[model samples]
Target: MAHCALEVADVFRSLGPGWHQSVNLSLGQLKVVSAIEQCRSAALGGHVLRCEGCAAIEVAYNSCRNRHCPKCQAAAARRWLEARQADLLPVEYYHVVFTLPAAISEIAYYNKAVIYGLLFDMAAETLRTIAADPKHLGAQIGATLVLHTWGSALTHHPHVHGIVPGGGLSPDRSRWVACRPGFFLPVRVLSRLFRRRFLEELEAVYHRGQLQFFGEHTELIDPGVFAKWLAPMRACEWVVYAKRPFAGPEAVLAYLSRYTHRVAISNQRLISLDERGVTFRWKDYRVDGRTRNKTMTLAANEFVRRFLLHVLPAGFHRIRHYGVLANPSRRENLSKIRALLHVALEAVDPDGDVSSCAAQPSFVCRHCGSPMIIIDMLQRSRPIRAPPPEQCHA
Candidate 1:
């Protein structure tokens, strides 16, 4: 793939130092900024590669490998998808999204670890709870939930994208239970349950002194005040909707490859960064058709601020598997399900195509398609500067 003329690294490298000095950022956010600025640059040591076919030589810089780095996720996504290919069931896959309202999103910014954890747990619970009901699917289902904290314009829109099979195993574990054709579960039922459980859990966390409030929300530190604030949200509808089932397992993989490891924005969406600030494309979901795609520009500092808003707390797993797909028993569950469905075991490469999931050499000869071998390591020419004391940890 051709590299984009502009990248997030370019934006960060140009504005990060000055912007960070003027703003307050968590240690995690600071690390993200620094990592993106130095990613694939001379600051990080790299290796020299020589092609076997044409004997072409090239120098490749190392990637920062930060989960939030746009340049790093493509490779990470490929590896993750390759692992997930084996778990694919020959059944319809449904896409479900659960979004926190704007009010809750503001609170999540301050309490990401707690609130985000609740979002995952509550979402998973909501699905399992609804699906297990006899009136509903009446089976145990598995889902892969991926959390995305940014909207098209880099706003703090915390949501989980769930990939679910159309059905699950029966209660007795004797047979496969499939969902209604082209439908997974009722969105309204899911939405109602999700809202009730999440808010209830959030209130409990607040009482336990696990949630923190700041700035305009400091008044929420009071128990009564917090309860009053959550009143509106309790009455409002939480967004939980499911899309049509995917055509096949291939389509499901294709969708996962795109959404599973995405950052706040991609390099391709960036148009230019100049004295006018950073201009980028965004989709206005409120609009229809081609008009939905529009470009907006933000002052450099503001752009960096918005981009950093999405840096997750350290050691948080943004990609999670729940219920039948839970990491502990996924392989065994899949084998049982395959048997119940009478799926024939076939010999197939988990990596699929060499040009796809399999890792490619860092460099290949342009003249002849041949592997590139690492010949030497390139050490950093200068000592790397340390981060500020406040931003040094995490």
Candidate 2:
């Protein structure tokens, strides 16, 4: 299995000098670069694991456990789903995506931690409020929202993916009100309400001096400039795409694995990362049914720049809950939802087969030629580590 870091390294080495030395480098991005370099498998602990296909033995190291680290996304993904298991309702769920326009991407990059936060809150609130309307489901809806910051080409495209139950409890909390079998809320109405609530909140944030613009957007500090800039977005059709409601709990889990804890890109998509720049596969949305995993090469510096664009703010969480999933009432709400739907309550790892889940491949130590079991798992208690160039031996 080729790791994203290794592929990054192949690109990282080819960049001209002063790649990481530029003054424009944000403090947030510098941390990601440092974290990724220190994540070489040799440092964390594997020795050498031989491949069955050939006599090849690779050295492996443990991941840095950072959310942004591609290697660590899987572990975090599993843990997130485990916690969310307690929040799953018995009814079918829907996957709703809310996309911001390109005009907003620059502002979003400047205030990612704030505007994105507002985006999630306002969007979730809008869905719940509208669904509770008598004309709609007329009940409280529960949802799980996760933020995605990168597009297929690694550009800054901030969007929110919502995993929402199709229906919810009425005001009386006495009975279940299932939504239309194939639908949840009207996308047309959700778009309008979402647009209004989001813009209203954005204006409040701007007025309180919470927003800032830099780089090419420095002039946006003026009030009139921002108002005019925002005007075009209102008429620009705020994108809201709703997929078919999920079939059942099993399908929900499958969807969670794909959406939750997903990094900008995955290792499986990478084909080669040698001297010919960097090459990887991606599903192009414009091409329709035709699928291609073609590899494209890019200069190392440009590649790293693109990858680093997605490094989130420190301590910022991408996944959040609303309504029934909120921490204060999640457990009780889950029980009630289960009762109303007459479905048996289930656990995250219902079968207690977590360990039996697929195990990652480990490298055998070069000296001992034995499978190197992890002797110590590094935690927050461990001292901070500097960058490691070559493989750090176990």
- TM-score of every prediction relative to native: 0.94, 0.83
Over 4 Å off in model 2, which ranges? 1-6, 13-18, 45-60, 274-276, 287-295, 347-394
Clashing pairs in 1: none
lDDT of 1 by residue, 219-312 (tens): 9998899889999998888889999999999999999999999999999999999999899999998765444888999987788889989999
For all candidates in order, the CA lDDT equals 0.88, 0.73
Residue 187 displacement (Å), model 1: 0.7
Q: Model 1, stretches more than 4 Å misplaced?
A: 16-18, 288-291, 346-363, 381-386, 390-394
In the range 1-394, model 2's lDDT, one tens digit per residue, is 3434444544554664345664356666665655655565454443444545445545455567777767677777876666555566667789999987887777888798888888789878988899889998899878889999998767788999999988888889998888988888889999998888888888899999999898788877999988888887777689888999888877898889888888887655556666656677665665766765555666556667778788888788788889877767877887787888788854335433344343544444455554445433433323234224222221
Clashes per prediction? 0, 9
The number of the candidate with the highest lDDT is: 1
Error of 2 at 358 (Å): 14
Q: Candidate 1, after superposition: displacement of residue 257 in Å?
A: 0.5
Quote the lDDT for 329 in model 1: 88
Q: Which window of 10 residues has the lowest lDDT sum in candidate 2?
A: 385-394
